[model samples]
Target: MAAGLEARGRTATQVRLRRRFLRFVRVRPGERVLEVGCGTGVVVRDLVGLVGRRGEVVGVDASRLMLGKARTLCRESARRTRLTLRVADGARLPFAAGRFDAALAITVILHVIDPMLVVREMARVTRPGGRVGLQDQDFGVVAVTHPERELTDRILHGVAAHIYPEPHSGRRLPGLLRAAGLEGVRLQTDVFQDTTLEPWTKTFLERRGERAVRFGIVDAATARRWLDGFTHLVAQGAFVLTINYYGAVGTKSR
Candidate 1:
C-alpha cells in the first residue's frame, strides 16, 4: 500500500479541509466517533477537538506505519486522553454491533478492494440513528489546466490503480450506501482550488512525486517533467485543479 498523503507540513491542508467536511455532518461533543483509515491522525486530532474532552475518538487503519504516525499525533494533542489508535481493515472492523455514535471513512474506500463491504461495516458498527459518513475524491471529475489533461489523467489513474486499486470509487458511494442498508443517505460535493501553483507544484513534487519515484511508478526524469509542466501552468495562472469530493452520510435504522 502507498504511504498516505499526510506528511509533516502537508497535514495543515488536510486538517483544514477535514474540519470543513466534518462540519457538514455536524459532529457533536461526547460522541463515540470512529475514523476509518485515519492517516497520521490529522483527522483524528480534529475530531478529538470537535467531540471535546468528554468524547472518544477511535482511529483505525490497515497500515501500521499510518497508525504509528496517528498514535504519535494523538499523544501530542490536547485531547490525547480521548483518542485511541488501532490497526484494522475496513472490510472487517473489529468491533461489536452498534459500537459508535458515528463513523467516518475519509479518502480510503477508493483504495480498498470492496468499498461496499467497508460501508456495510461502517454502518454495522454505528449505533441506531447514528451517522455513517464517507468522503472521497471523484477521479473522473478531476480537472487540470494542463494541455495534456488526458495523458495526465491516464498516468495518474494508472498510478492509483497500481498503488491503490479502485481510484475513482466515489462515483459509487450512493449505491454503496444504499447497499449497506442505511437510511436517508445523502451525497454532497465540495471543490478545493489552489490559489497558487508554486506551492502546489512544490508540495506535489515533494510529496506525491517523490513517492512515485520511490515506488518505481515513474522515473525521476518523468517526475521532473510533471513538476515542470505544473510550474508552467501555475506561472500562466492556469494552474487550476479541481477535485470533486463526494461525501455521503446516512442514519442506521434501529
Candidate 2:
C-alpha cells in the first residue's frame, strides 16, 4: 500500500490530473494549502513546488508511519518550500477555522466512517474564497482483461464494496461537498487506461484474488483461473485496465 501510494502520483495520468486540479484551485504562490491523508506525500511534493518557499503546505495523516515515509519522500520539496507534516484524523483536524487557502482530501473519504465530518472540517478550515478539491476512485467501474466476465465483475465489485469503506465516494463527492456548504461545485473525471503494469494495477489481483471466496464473490479455483488469465494476457502484450477517477472542486462561500 505504501509503495503504491508513493508511486501512484508519479504516473502520467496522475500528473495530468494533478495539473488540472491545481488549475481548478487556482493555486497561488505563498498561499497555505492542506492535504489530508497525505500518505507518502506525492501530492505534497507537487503542491510544494507550486506554492514556493513563501507558501505553506501541511499534510496530515492518521498514521505516524505514513507521515514518516512522507517526510522522507518529500524531503527535497520540503526544503524548497514550507512543508509541515502532522499526524491527525480526517474527521478531526487539529487546526483553527479558515486556516487554509485550499484544502484537499484525495482518495481519502472512502476510508472514513464519517466522511461528512471530514468534508465539513475541510470546508471549515478553508477560508472564504478558498477552494476545496476532492478526488476519489470508484472501483465499481473498473474494467480489466479477464477470460471470465462473471468472475471479473465479482472481484471488482467485491473489492469496492468490501475493501473500501465508501466505494461510491467518487460519485458522492459533489453532494458531500455541497452539503458541507461549499458552493460552485463542479465535477470532472479522468480515466486511466494502462496497457502496462503500474501502481494502479499493481498487486490488484494478489490483494483481492484469493479473497474471491472470502468476499463470497466466486469459488476459489475459479478466482485462480481469472488471475492466471491476466498473467497469460500480460505475457501476450494484451493486458489492459481502465479505471475512472472523479474530481470535484468547490468554493467556500464568502
What's each prediction's clash count? Answer: 0, 0
Give per-residue CA lDDT, model 1, range 86-117, as digits (tens): 99998899999999999998888888887888
For residue 205, what is the lDDT in candidate 1? Answer: 38
Residues 110-158, candidate 2, lDDT per residue (tens digit)? 8888899999999999999999999888777788887787768878787
Evaluate residue 231 in candidate 2 and report its C-alpha lDDT on the 0 to 100 scale: 82
Which residue pairs clash in candidate 1?
Answer: none
> Which 10-residue span in candidate 2 carries the lowest summed lDDT?
197-206
Q: Model 2, which residues run further than 4 Å from truth? A: 213-220
TM-score of each: 0.86, 0.93
